[model samples]
Target: MSKVVLITGGSSGIGKSIGEFLTYKGYDVYGTSRTPERYTDSKFRLVALDVADTTSIKKAIQTVVEGSGRVDVLINNAGAGITGPIEEIPDVEIKRNFETNLFGPINVIKAVLPQMRLQNSGLIINITSIAGYMGLPYRGIYSASKGALELITEAFRMEIKDFNIRMTNLAPGDFATNIAAGRYHAPVTKGSPYETKYGSVLKNIDEDVDNGNDPALVANAVFKIINTPYPKIHYKVGAFLQKFSVVLKRILPDKTYEKMLMKHYKL
Candidate 1:
């Protein structure tokens, strides 16, 4: 029997790409979306799900299990983006970021863990971002949420490894996607202290995203991770510079790394 794979936020962007890719690769792929009707991709089945809601997550996973017998892989790819100065971002928006990017994945993992444990074999891949490790200039909350998720994935890996289960953090640097268009920009008025800086930085961030690498590359990375017998705990996908930045952050001094990031963003 083919391996059953479940992907969250599979309606569009990277999630959709991965779902389609895995489906074509012969895996029994099921994708979750807030409005399943909106996803017309015939390559994969769609399930109505809201990762932010525990009830929806549980129901969605249960549906997949009922239909497929088991989920061999669960890709926590559903996420949202927010950009703005850390201080000016509203509390609600920060909470929203964490809910979607961090808590959402956590809930999904929780719902699926029991089944994975029972089966004694499974793979959990969380779609984190390069910013998760190196904080972005204006996208502080996004970075923080992903960073938290990365940490969570690492901890979870330790706890679950004994069950013959595996977890990996797939950190993509940037990819051309609707994420930039959908990102929430913190409120910045004309007279606000951060208006000029925020505008400049936000513009630069958008440009980078617009010129980002193909989403298919990320899908390819996901494919490799699933097929590998023992995948690395963390995989960074994208340009050499972006992946190197993550490495440099670890080896370089704090202030030196800070300077490099600021230079990249023209801050």
Candidate 2:
């Protein structure tokens, strides 16, 4: 029997690419989206899901397992981006961002764990971001949410490794996706202190995202991780400079790293 793969936010963007690619690779792919009608792909099955909602997450995973009998791989790729100055970002917006980017995956992981543990084999790939490691100026909330997921994934690995279940954090630097258009912008009031700075930083951020690597790169990475017996704990996809930025942040002094990031974002 083919391995069953479940991917959240699979209606579009990186999730869609991954779902389609995996289906072609012979996996029984099930993808989740808030609006199932929005996804017209015939290759993989689409299930209605709202990751931020625990009931929705539970129902979606239950549907997949009922249809497929097993979930060999679970990819938590559903996430939202919130951009703007930290202070300008509303509390509600921050909550919504974290709910999708961090807690959404958490709910899915919880829903799938029982079956995965009972089967004694599974792989969970959490799609994180390089920004998770370094704080971005205007996208601080997005970064924070991803960073939380990264840490949670690491901890989850330790907890579940004994169950023959594997976990990986796929930190994509940037991928060409609909994320920018759908991203939440924290309210920037007129004459606010962060208005001009936020605009400049956001513009630069948008350009970089527009020029990001294809989502197919991420799909290929996912394929490799699934096929490998002992995949690394972390996988990064993007251009050399973008991927290497994580390494730079690790090796450089705090002040130097901040300077480099500021220069890169033109802040």
Candidate 3:
């Protein structure tokens, strides 16, 4: 039988691309959405799921496992983006982003572990962000949430190794997607201290997303990871410079790297 794969937030964007590509590769693919009815044209099956809700996460996993008899791979791709001056962004919004990006993925993984252990084999891929590797100016909250997930994946790998299960974090750079439309933006308040700089940074951020590489790149990476016998703990998929930025951080002094980011963001 073909491998059964479940992808949260797979109705669109990178998740949709991964789901469609795997389907074409002959995998049994199921994608999740808060409103599955909205994606009538999805190439793979879409099940109702809201990552923030534990009840919904359980229901969605049960739906996929009951239908496919097993879940060989799970891509935790459901996440929300938030951008703004850290002080200006509402506390509620920050928590909400974490709920979707970090806590939600954790709960989903928890829901699937029992089944994965019962099967004695499984793979879980958490779709993180290149931004997760560092603190970006207006996107700090997004960075922290995804970065936390990255570290958690590191810890999870060791804990689940005995169960014949695998977990990895795939951090993608800006991809041409509707993520900008969905992201929460703290309003650029009139005469506020951060108004001018935040406004300019926000504009640049949107343009970057608009000009980003195709989502198919991320999908291809996901496919490769699934087929690997022993996948690495972390994988990054993006433009050369974006991926290189992570390496630069590792080799460069903290202040120097911070300076480079400040210059790049024109701060």
lDDT of each: 0.92, 0.90, 0.96
Please write out the lDDT profile of model 3 over residues 111-166, one tens digit for every residue.
99999999999999999999999999999999999999999999999999999999
Instruction: Tell me which residue pairs clash in candidate 2.
Output: none
Q: What is every candidate's alpha-carbon RMSD to the true fold?
A: 1.0, 1.1, 0.6
In candidate 3, stretches whose alpha carbon ends up further than 4 angstroms from where it belongs are none
- Listed per model in order, the count of residue pairs whose N, CA or C atoms clash below 3 Å is 0, 0, 0
Give candidate 2's TM-score: 0.97
**Candidate 2, residues 1-267: lDDT per residue as tens digits?**
999999999988999999999999999999988999875755689999998788998888889889989899999999998898887788999999999999889989999999999899999999999889889898889989999999998899999999999999999987789899999987666899887778888788788889889999999999999999987888888889888988998899999999988887776
TM-score, every prediction? 0.98, 0.97, 0.99
- Candidate 3 has its poorest 10 consecutive residues by lDDT at 11-20
TM-score of 3: 0.99
Better of 1 and 3 by TM-score: 3
Candidate 1, residues 61-139: lDDT per residue as tens digits?
Answer: 9999999999999999999999998888899999998999999999999999999999999999999999999778889
Best by TM-score: 3
Q: Rank by TM-score, descending?
A: 3, 1, 2
